[model samples]
Target: MLKILPAKEIYLQGNEHAVLLLHSFTSHTRDMKKVATSLHAQGYTCYAPLYRGHGHTPEQLLHYQVDDWWQDVVDAHQFLLNEGYQKISVIGLSIGGIFTLKLAQFEKLSQIIVLSVPIDKEPAQLKQRIIDYAYNYKTIEGKSASQISQEMEPFHHMALDAMSAFQQFIQATMQQLDRITVPIAIYYGERDDASYAQSAETIYQHVHSSTKQKRGFENAKHLMTLGRDQDEIIQEIIDFLE
Candidate 1:
């Protein structure tokens, strides 16, 4: 056993303005921890939920589908409502950004902030990333080269199915971008893939919100919150929310 510590959901209570922090796919809630804590310190209550089958072994992750993660996103929002948070803003990364758009279609949101969201579907790239995530997870678990190879043998087919479902979800969400009328801010790293910048532009052009803004950080990449410009990113988010 490599004794890797598992990630968990984060809930920090503050004032009435609630912020839902959503992490990227194949990532943990810890990815949103810094931003969550910063927001909490600024008197904004924050909740970051761990999606189903995440924060565990990659084999466990493969058992859950995209639909399951969407449900988790919904449940997390409802939880804040139950906690008496009337003014709710959502900040999401990657697939979490897609869920935010989907939620905006049916729910009332105060603000929407999305980072590194993918607008165009690249099935081959997405599948390869999923496979790479599995291999990385097994490596972290202290598996040998031969064992990891054998374990990953059965995951190719499953990865394909997962990728298909993910593409469908993205398409469905993209179709409803015009339904979102809340104040929206989109950010992408200049160093990230061009798809993210394109996604930001597409989202900005599609949303019906009058107060929409898009920006890119030069010192950042796919994971902006963890990038070199993290402090600047946090400050920008606070400025937007305020």
Candidate 2:
């Protein structure tokens, strides 16, 4: 049986490395349970740290910024280290993927994976994708933008204090991509309008990591984690990790 742990406790697997599954922006750890379960079955202890502003109501997300999200990963990493798991792997989707890319370069983990990472939450050339993400985010299941925005407005944009931090997040990750020597995998959909594949392409090229792979689903969109393509995507992840 799968052992699910609360955010307050560390779930350890004796004699095994730990893997972290980080959820996307505005999502709770529940979103990662499937992926975490897959890794958990592979003899790895997996934990999904709830992003500060996410998993809660919209009111909670507005209070978060990228830095706050980074801190969550840092804490999770330390938690696993303290648990006696000397090796680690990290996998993240969307905004969580952004932090994973940032962490991969320096966390010195065993492996790293990103799924449609939110390299640009602003969705620059991918404006349509942002609209879709935001729209589906709140509008999904009949929730409206106003309803979601009212709750997410304060955090609708990068917090003022974290603008520089986000900038550095991009810069530092770029400069240190060559410093990363672990196995890295980039997963995304070819049809995704939310996150540009260029970001992943850049990583595949610049990162010094010798074992890096980028896999794409031709029919999948940005929410590659939860769509018809999920099976293929999950299988790809399993193959790559193994």
Candidate 3:
């Protein structure tokens, strides 16, 4: 376990094939450890990296946006490449998954598996935002606006201009999908809050990779790999990489 200031480095067990695990927005690398463990137990070295402002405090991520994340993924790539690993595979959860695909649009990777990616940033897509505005500082029962404050904690007071940049990122990448020639697999939960119900299907239809797929699990939430039967999801990833 290596905490490199901005990026926490947790090396999974195996030393053979390497896989990089990037976590979601408003989250640290803690959860990816589950997938990393499975991959490592199967003899693949795994790198679970924490982003610049994530997994630290909500304030850390408030100012940072999606571009910051893309850079981190590339930094992780350089780190892994420097470690002498070839034929790398990347697996990411939620926003991390989108970052993985963003990287795939340009970088060369053995394969990329994206879970719960935000293909679009519709207001309906983020339930948290709706809840925040609807309640308007009102304390909630199941969860309060303050409880959900982490959603905007890092960028709370800012202008939220980060979204426009993310829009550009999506617009640029979606048009250049054909440029991504690597094997890509996407996994999403049927009950994901970040996506419209048909997100997985939409990705399958629009993405340009010849080797791509979409699999949605019943009752799986946005954090599908961390939900029930998470191991089975990791197994699907293992099979994909194998």
Each prediction's number of clashing residue pairs: 0, 0, 2
lDDT of 2 by residue, 35-60 (tens): 76776677778877886755433444
Number of the predicted model whose TM-score against the real structure is largest: 1
Worst 10-residue stretch by lDDT in candidate 3? 133-142
- Model 3 regions more than 4 Å off: 1-7, 122-156, 194-197
TM-scores, in order shown?
0.96, 0.78, 0.80
Off by over 4 Å in 1: none
TM-score of candidate 1 relative to the true fold: 0.96
Tens digits of per-residue lDDT for model 1 on 149-220?
A: 999976676647677878888998998899999999999999998888988999999999999999999999
RMSD of 3: 5.5
TM-score order, best first, reads 1, 3, 2
Error of 3 at 235 (Å): 1.2
Q: State the lDDT of candidate 3 residue by residue for 112-161, as single tens digits.
A: 99888776764233334423432342232235455655554533445535
What lDDT does candidate 3 reach at residue 73?
85
